[model samples]
Target: MRKGRDSKCLGSIIFVLVFCFAISALPFASAIQRQKAKIEKHEFGELADGIALYTLTNRNGLEVQISNYGGAVVSVKTPDRAGRMADIVLGYDQPQSYADDTVFFGVLVGRYANRIAKGKFSLKGVEYQLAQNNPPNHLHGGVRGFNKVIWHPREVSRADGAALELSYVSKDGEEGYPGNLSVKVTYILTNANELRIEYSATTDKETIVNLTNHSYFNLAGAGSGSILQHVLRINASRFTPIDKTSIPTGELKMVKGTPFDFTRPTVIGSRIDQADEQLRFGKGYDHNFVLNKKGKELSFAAEVYEPKSGRVLEMWTTEPGVQLYTGNFLDNVHGKAGKFYNKRDAFCLEAQHFPDSPNKPSFPSPVLEPNQRYMQTTVYKFTVRGAGRGR
Candidate 1:
């Protein structure tokens, strides 16, 4: 007809300008997914008793603040080596200064983080007692553990450029420990200056788990006291000796000439003044080593180094065991900006699962049956090796 009706009117104006540019980008992609879910619900945190607090910022300015009470972290502002940041993980700033503590500084341990000796355990055939609160041995989750209850904050995402995630749920027996676990802990802050912790959990019945995170670092800040000239390292060749009430005596031994030979990188006051007998049975290096890497993956257990705030940190874990401790009965307690916390002044690697390992049947067996799903993941990271420069 008229040149095929002008080529069908230019194909209907290029299909109506591509359907009006895809309906004008559908409200800019639903307003960028509702502004990323309102900046991830404004990074949560708004509660009192069942505590809550999640704040994460990165791009190297690294600022992490977690607190679901015992999901504890409370504060960590990495940088050092002159990059300057201050607070490196210790607690007690408010919220009644962690209400009432025992020895777990920056909380979030768990139903079975470490130690379960006399508190009893007999799974399948049924025989649980728990709640002994150490001494008769029940530690970690007994004395109302989970770093002392209170966790319910969930969802805080930003996961990159400086991560942010805080989650919790512990029903199924609450303190008596039996399941319904559901945990999630993420705290990234990359760009190299590190500060990462990632853990996830799941349970339903046949319990007996081990989760960790007892903070208490002191990269030359938090209470500013003894880390005994730092410098640690713990790839572990084997260690699981404890007694005098610190439990674990199933003996996995051999850390070469004891004092738990940190394989290579030493100097936490060089053998912590070696009076060896396992440093007087852990009045110094608490115990648990083992992490020569196996099974689940994750890798690289410990590595400290403060040297006057050149920071470092470096942990990493899929959990097989890593509990260096060194705060050695920290006394005077008075952290967070008010400072004070004397004694060894701060230290805790705690990547965990070897204190009691549920009465050690040749160790390594945290149980977790009924549908089987008890995971672990740890990462300390934090950086600055020389001339700081974090921002």
Candidate 2:
């Protein structure tokens, strides 16, 4: 009888201890589960037309500040391995500075990205002439492209993320393009730390369209000096070679045994100074990589890793090509927080159809008719490596 009573007492004690422990852990578990994705809207500033700028922030510690003036991404803050957030995209502090920016900065470029030879292209036997802003060629949409236009803003709801939808209509004969193009761009910030950009367009007339975002990214945090120490891996076995004018020669050259080969995770500075014809022409890397995928699917394009911050940025896109620009011409330009942006201060991974694709019939076609909708999706997924707590 005594043994039976002792056993019952021990059992009762064990149950009480376990119950107390579970009760103590309940609040912590609830706190974690309550950390859902969120969206916060705030006024960034006012443009010349008095239109207000806006910002979006999600629960994953990612924030993007944008302006309707040109649908520019003014700032992007992401967390490092230590959970410390820092701005990684280069831009100006004042909104008006972007309006006067000679460099593309963090804005959208369109109509045609790269260059069109002699500022001319023949579409259906009609020779369209564009502004020769780049001297001998038409560059980045002919002086005033979509990057220079204001877009109307609309807020969208996502059950698992936050979104901002922007729309603009490109007038016929504007920038020497033939069609009245209607464009829609959506920016989504997911709880998984993904910055997804989806682009869609429809044209009234048959014309060529190539669009991309020009965000100078430095994973070590913007204004933190050279990104040469960073590692890059582009999923391409071939690349487009450029000419003296930085226009593609309409040839896809193999990257094997060449300085342009990034088949593995290699440091950017490893062969940047190598004596190669292509390097001399670009003055650095200002070329496009032929992505290894069918043009229709969203697949991995490239990845960049910043060792200092242990931040990894993986790019996935449906576009057939990616332009890797090393900011070779960024000289003495002023950026945010009293920092001077110089050559190779940052890099751009512009996902799009190949450069000068309209002229290169051999390349993927950028032509869109009245009935066909042009759609492209690119995602910049950020994640931190190393031991630390993630928000």
Candidate 3:
């Protein structure tokens, strides 16, 4: 009878062990399903009425909500290593804050994105003067850029999953930028776990044009902490060194033996504190990297890998250069949940023609003439690998 009782006890132990394993597997399975769930898009308002919200969700259940107002990315929901969702891009949850924000959060900067030195550049024997919003230089479309004005929506469909097309028209002499430029920006959330932003524009007169979305990203989830620990990899052998005023000094320097070397992946804070002139000039890293990629077409520019959350952001763009800004001037702005955004709270990877390109004859020209289409596309794809498999 004792032997019989021993065998029964052994069987019960095995049954309990198998049950525990099965229970553990259930959470994993549920996580994957939640990540791959259907995406939903909801309309916030009419296109003619001003701004609207459109959300694109992924199969792994990542959702990116945007507004046609400034082609702004309102919120981005991605899964952490534990399958928990958090918004990683910095922006206001309310429309009022976005409408009255200090800096450009998630705006479609254009006509010219970055600054042009002294707010003037001679193009083809004609000198054109631009608005000097950034003191001695012009910045991000000059006061009334694509962000401040409301844009009309061209196409949007719930059937497209999470894709929408938004367009804007800038009249002549607006903000000192020449030409009546017509612009279009399309955002797509793909099943491959990527958010692609494609831009196209055409002008009626000769004018300088460079368009880019100003989206601040925080891989450890937005408002989590400083981005010093995130590993970064930029596909470039050289970078465009900047002057004290953050303007390109017309010098294309190699990244060999410098703190700017990102050929191999390294943490952002690895050399950010180095007492170098370039770092000091930027107050951090606000310089543009002249991509090693030959020809003026689409190429991979940079990548951000957050270890704790296992979230990766890969940036691919058709522009010739990519600027890496470490968010040095966030200025303790209070965001959602009263979270104060201090320095290094977010980072921006803006792809475009070199800054102050019009002034530097050695750099690529950003001028677009009549009958010519000015086109630039940049795609930011998010993928969660490692321990974050859907969950």
Candidate 4:
């Protein structure tokens, strides 16, 4: 009887311990599950119609908010080395404010992202004219480009990240381009702390297409201060010089010994005020650098570092050129959180084909044929510079 009682007690203790162990592990398991990617939808505001905003959050807690109105990236929250998060892209507080955004903010630019000389281009012996919104040259598609239109949005299922897919259809002769262009842009916030932009387009008629995101980034956080202190490096030896009207001169000028030389990490404002004609024309650094790439595969384009915040931004793209545009045109515009954005407050690294490609026969063609599909991918990866990694 005594032996049986001892055996029974041992069995009961084992059972109780097992149950306690399992109960203790529950919170840990729940935390692991919470680390998975997630997405949420919220009503932004009405433009001419109501619009929706989709927020994509990755495993690392990085968040990106995008809207179907112009497919704009409303905000991007990232953490610095100290693990404090802040919004790094510039934008207005309200969705309605984006409708009157002249600096482009974080919207998607399309049709012809950069410039077309004299607002005209010859395609297959036919001359086409476009809106001279920038005066003498067409800029960012036209008066009503992709940035000003609404897009269809849907959630895309992905195992590696949270994705938002936006689609738009441009009617034939819309924005003075001859095509019924169907475009799809996918914004994926990956688990690796990267915001990947995938662009694909198809057209029924032959037309010119160059699409890019115009996100003004201030790595130290938007509206906090000037981005002139940020360090920048571009993997390129040559750049396309622009004319007085901001149109490319059709020459791939060497960046060596010029203010455009960002082959090494350098302060953005170091040479911005130099007595160079190109800098004078742009009022700062606003030129396209021909990337040092061999093929159409995705390659490193540029990297930016903000020392104070220890934040780093690396860019990779399949495009042949990147247009670095300092916000020299921002004229004390009111922005989010009651902050005022002024000149040099932000910077943009737009991955795209060379400007004026439609007019410059020597440049890479931006034409898409009827049966061919246009595809482009650009990745903006965020990281932090560890201690002693300062430039």
Please name the candidate that would achieve the greatest TM-score relative to the true structure: 4
Query: What would the TM-score be for candidate 3 when compared with the true structure?
Result: 0.86
- Candidate 4: residue pairs that collide: none
TM-score of each: 0.32, 0.91, 0.86, 0.92
- The worst-scoring run of ten residues by lDDT in candidate 3 lies at 37-46
**Residue 309 local lDDT, model 3:** 88
Candidate 1 runs further than 4 Å off = 1-60, 63-78, 84-121, 126-161, 164-185, 190-200, 213-228, 231-267, 280-307, 310-322, 325-348, 351-354, 360-391
Residues 1-391 of candidate 1: C-alpha lDDT, one tens digit per residue: 9999999999999999999999998976775455321112232234353555666555435677776667677788876766678877788766556757787887878868777878888877877777776678787887776676666665554535445566677888776777688777766655555666777777877787888888888888888778888878789888888888888789888899766787888778766767677678677888888988779789888888887668888888888888888888877877666777877888889887888777678888888776766767777777767744321
Each candidate: RMSD: 21.5, 3.8, 6.1, 6.2
Order the numbered candidates by TM-score, best leading: 4, 2, 3, 1
TM-score winner between 2 and 4, please give it: 4
lDDT of each: 0.75, 0.87, 0.83, 0.93
**Full candidate order by lDDT, most accurate first:** 4, 2, 3, 1
User: C-alpha displacement of 88 in model 4, angstroms?
Assistant: 0.1
The deviation in Å at residue 125 for candidate 2 is: 0.5
lDDT of 2 by residue, 84-145 (tens): 99999999887678878988998888888778888998888999999999989998898889
Tens digits of lDDT, candidate 4, 1-391: 9999999999999999999999999987787678879899998876666588899999878999999888899899999889899999999777788888888999999988988888899888999999999999899999999999989999999887999999999999998989899999999999999999999999999999999999999999999988989999999999999999999989999999999999999999998998999999999988999999987799999999999899999999999999999999999999988999999999999999999998888988899999999999999999999767878
Residue 259, model 4: Cα distance from true site in angstroms: 1.0
* C-alpha-based local distance difference test score of model 1: 0.75
The 10 consecutive residues of candidate 1 with the worst lDDT sum are: 35-44
